[model samples]
Target chain A: MQQIKKDFPIFKRTINGKPLVYLDNASTTQKPIVMLKVLENFYFTSNANIHRGIYTLSEEATDKYEAVRKKAAKFIGARTEEEIIFTKNTTEAINCVRVSWGEKNIKKGDEIVVSSLEHHANLVPWQELAKSKQAALKIIPLTNDYTLDAEAYKKLLSPKTKLVCLTVESNVTGTIVPVKQMTALAHAVGAKVMIDGAQSVGHIPTDVHNLNCDFFAFSAHKMLGPTGVGVLYVKQSLMEEMAPFMYGGEMVESVKATSATYRSGPWKFEAGTPNIAGVIAFGAAIDYLSNIGFKKIMAHEQELLAYAKKMLAKYPQVKIFSPSQKHAGGIISFAISGVHPHDIATIFNNEGIAIRSGLHCAEPLMNYLGVYGTARMSFYIYNTKKDIDTAEKALKKVLKTFKL
Target chain B: MDIYTETILDHYQHPHHTGALNDATVSATEHNPLCGDVIKLDLKIKNNVVEKIGFVGNGCAISQASISLLCDAVEGKKISSLKKLKPKDIYDLLGVTISPGRIKCALLGLSALQKALKLTKN
Candidate 1:
């Protein structure tokens, strides 16, 4: 992990002349040298637009760009490359599903179920869809221990349940949901399932086929890749059932003034000239993570999270929201009984420790948990136990300053 | 920890005037919805001078302390000069450099103060 930390230049710098202790990996993971080098290499060597030219450079660029779709497909265990649609980010990818699937299938009286723990990217779009189509947007509540309540989800399911949008892992509480069990229930009621993988893909091992989810959405930026590139996986069986979110040059096969024939498979979803370099480099990011292996990464993160948990236990005023270390991912959302999250975060920042404070884009979850906000510390592949120790030490200083 | 000095924490722990005034002439409120920090300002003005000031809120120590300081800053000052207050003044009053992320938290009180002054002026 020390060698891995060296690959990210951000760790080399000092914050306020103190060594930077970064624990905000859930917001966005810092890119490694390998990812950045490939990104630069693409712009320098193959800068041509994909699928637009017969020239050598364009051919090479298109091959590299499309190759990422293949890499992404295999990375997530999708049946084919045709199932992967590259978009701007996870938000855009989820919006693509809402635009293409929700607009077409959801109708008045139909119910779209979302879990208690969706990020706004997965929640708000469904709300808008329900508002537009007059569909019912239902929610699965969380248990007291932060796990998704299975009984509430069963009660929400009916023949009218058209879709169930869920997060594979919550960004705020770091609760790794049992998507397989929930998907089975949703399928019993003939509802399609979409998994939000923004906080899950890089942190946990995932297999789309084994999970049997109808769709999955994730971003490269959160998984050690460059920004502006994300992937949406549509089940091959559902491909013809949905329409494209946008229409432009690359998506259509042949067009007249009034009507056009669209391309089959994932290409139909992509409209514009894509982020060529970012997509190609995304393949490199997947390669980087795959080579390191998720087992190794998850083990390291669990150790860091356990160390954080132990450190936080020393402060009796602290109330942690995430359940147990085994049931959770590598995040810990907590509040020091009297001190607000913003102040804790500020104090942590002053000590050169970087953590996130706020509702973390899950305001509904914050309301559900009966908290204004919680200070969050998330770990990643590059994070070490020392970072957690520094964070804990800084938190003690924060407690002293607040007199809590 | 440049932002949370002893003076600020002192104000945070023992905040100076809190609660709404029943006889107040003007009042206003603002909140940082992202973190749920809220500040409400009530001002009692007599003859174009601020006779009394109070803030009611719950938030981070920075916001609570800053509002507590603002409570003392507005009293006995001419109402005309109150509207001219800026974030720089608050920073000067607190004697600490605020980072960009917590600027909203620090200025939430001043934001309500400016809004209350608008009503008090009329």
Candidate 2:
């Protein structure tokens, strides 16, 4: 399928007369026109504080807001609506687990296995949790091809392991992990699994039930939804002891003279006035993505990755750090031998092809790859072959400017 | 032709005064955690006079080149003189118009030097 360029208004703009070609999907995606309209319609028509409203508008807002929970549940293959909790973002969701679930389960001397390829969102909370609880954090290293070494991960699992927190895909390298097989391994050793789907849930088919992961966290913006909204899917069987990530507002079921009791289901964890418009818009985004189908999106991205690889190979100075397309997702992380990645990005900006160049929020991975940072070119449903041609021309400008 | 000019690229490719001082009187390291850019400055001072100054870092071209340029400009100069150096001086030395996003990158080495000079006096 061709990119519906008109569907995104940003594609109509130009930088110095150069048409815009957004190549930063790994960072965040440009919202479609339909998504924008959803946000507007919610504010214009159905704006009200949900779950606490008594009027008709409030009830209508509440219905639209809670309906997204069901959509998100089916989107991720969660067993029921009660299993989904709306969070501010993936980072907050992971932090929620660190405090709500991790504090009660992980004790001193217990081990948590995490891969080195995780973003700071997935890595930092576990590090802090392990530090505060005095637990052990075991790391799984990446192989020669930059994919997580599954063989090495098997060695890290044991009865002493209490949790396995990792990303389903590495945002920096776009390497997809075998989360299903890894979750089964964690389960065999009586360990719970938490999958950071910030980079994978929207790109691939994620079935929390099939994977059997106890917890799954993902952001909405990564999947064509609105920002400031994310999801945390907790298995119903594990919810008996789960505490609210925050405690206030409608979260408290009843107030008493001495003590208070909180509500059951996901409402207990949602402790404030939710992002009503963002959630409703995110629900619309879910329907939009489902309509396109993951199969079409994946196949289109695969084609983009292959074509970009062939074009990059022509330049001897171009050095790619992402694994081959078979293992890699849609991102192409690379550096031109002598030129800095930041320089390449500035040059791309001039060419109107937006790309990201930095540590990409995965500093430990940068340490592993032995580079300061890499320039990344990512693809989504909106990008097309013509954008690749523009990127090729931009690369030529960069090499010429650097005299490489 | 733009920010990545010939002089900037030359310094980035072949940085001057890049290494650690063995008997340095003062040293400081600064990092931009937002993008993981690191710059370390080592100073050798003899009775308030700048005897030797060197740096080491792994960052963007603007940051790395700015440090290399900073080292060359401050060598053999008094530490007190560097205390009054302003951001504009580095901008002029780099010979490029830095955009708002990269202002921090251009000033990373300067900040490290300013801190290192302060520590040397103490």
Candidate 3:
């Protein structure tokens, strides 16, 4: 197994005079040294605008910028480089799809399907689209164990359904959704499918082609890369059908007094100067993940999750929220009987252990689970069983201190 | 990382004046759906003054404890005077600067208080 801890410099620092045990990977993964170096090198050496400049520096910068697009294409198994459009983050990527595809295709009486497991980023855009287009927004309910009811989802789909947007892995429940099956069902109904891969991409292997999704969106920061860079993958055939979300320089073919011709899909969607350094660092993140091998990373996280669940089970006051014994992703969400999640998190913080407290961006799921909030501990390759042990110890101390 | 103060934790561990007031003239509930923090405030008013205050609901320790602190702060004060309380004032009482993300948690109690005060006027 790779020594995942060695790649991150932040782990070397002390928190509260103790070694930091970061369990907030679900919010944002810590950057690897490789990605940090790539960003530094870009600023120190090749910092210039792309596509419009005639200087050697601009050519080099453009080459590197476009190279990252190719890497992104390969990473998500996009058939062509033109299918990948870069944005500020996953929220921007999803908004682009809503504005472009949703605006043109969805009409009054049409329906868009979403699940309760969505982050606000996914839910709000669709709600706005539905309101503007006079379309209906349908939601798939979760099972008692917090898994999406696929059977219920099938019943929700109909000829009126224009699109289906779902998460690949839930940020709160940590449930690995059946994206392939869901995509197939949506496609069978002639409705397009968009997968939110924000929690899946680098944590697991993602192939857009194999998943047969119409669009896939993920952020670089959640995958050990820099922030402000995200990828949107549209299938080659669907790219032509989707309208441009933004129109500006570098995306026009020609201009006349009356009309202006726009460039093809991806470039046409990216409006202004992009986050060049963030994109270059994203490629470095991909390289680091590829070198370590995603399979090993998955295995390590699975082991950690199992150990965490087992250890947390010993706490009678604790209530775990995800489906039992499933190979869910690294997140573990639970609530203590008498202790509020914020209290648990604060006590853990004093111990130099970091965890997330709240709805984890899935407010609907929290409502369905009938809880105020939960304390979430998410793992990555750098996290180990020892980290889980530390979290458990800290949690026990909190429970006892609270006299729960 | 010290987003929560020691007093906040103490209040969380041992909440003060937590319950419901059956004879309350005003009552209201406020929730932060983003974090699933909920607080219900009940106040008994006499001659336009808050005679007693109570709260009951589920929330993070910060919110529950803050509500507990709020109960103590506004128990005998005039409703008009207590309505002027701001989130920063509450944070100052706790002696800590909360994270931007957690400001809602601290504000949950104050929001409930305001709503309950409005209810009493009605």
Clashes of 3: 0
The chain B TM-scores of all candidates, as shown, are 0.94, 0.95, 0.91
Tell me how candidate 3 scores on lDDT: 0.87
Q: What docking grade does candidate 2 earn?
A: medium
What interface RMSD does each of the candidate structures achieve? 1.0, 1.6, 2.5
The DockQ values of the predictions, listed in order, are: 0.80, 0.64, 0.60
Better of 1 and 3 by TM-score: 1
Task: Please report, in order, the local distance difference test score of every candidate based on alpha carbons.
Answer: 0.90, 0.90, 0.87
DockQ agreement of candidate 1 with the native complex = 0.80
In candidate 3, what are the lDDT values of residues A65-123, reduced to their tens digit? 99999999998888888899999999999999998888899999999999888988889
RMSD, candidate 3, Å = 2.8
* Tens digits of per-residue lDDT for model 1, A19-85: 9888998999999888999999988877899888999999999999988999999999999999999
Q: What TM-score would candidate 3 get against the native?
A: 0.92
- Any runs in candidate 1 off by more than 4 Å, and if so which? B45-47, B119-121
TM-score of each: 0.96, 0.97, 0.92
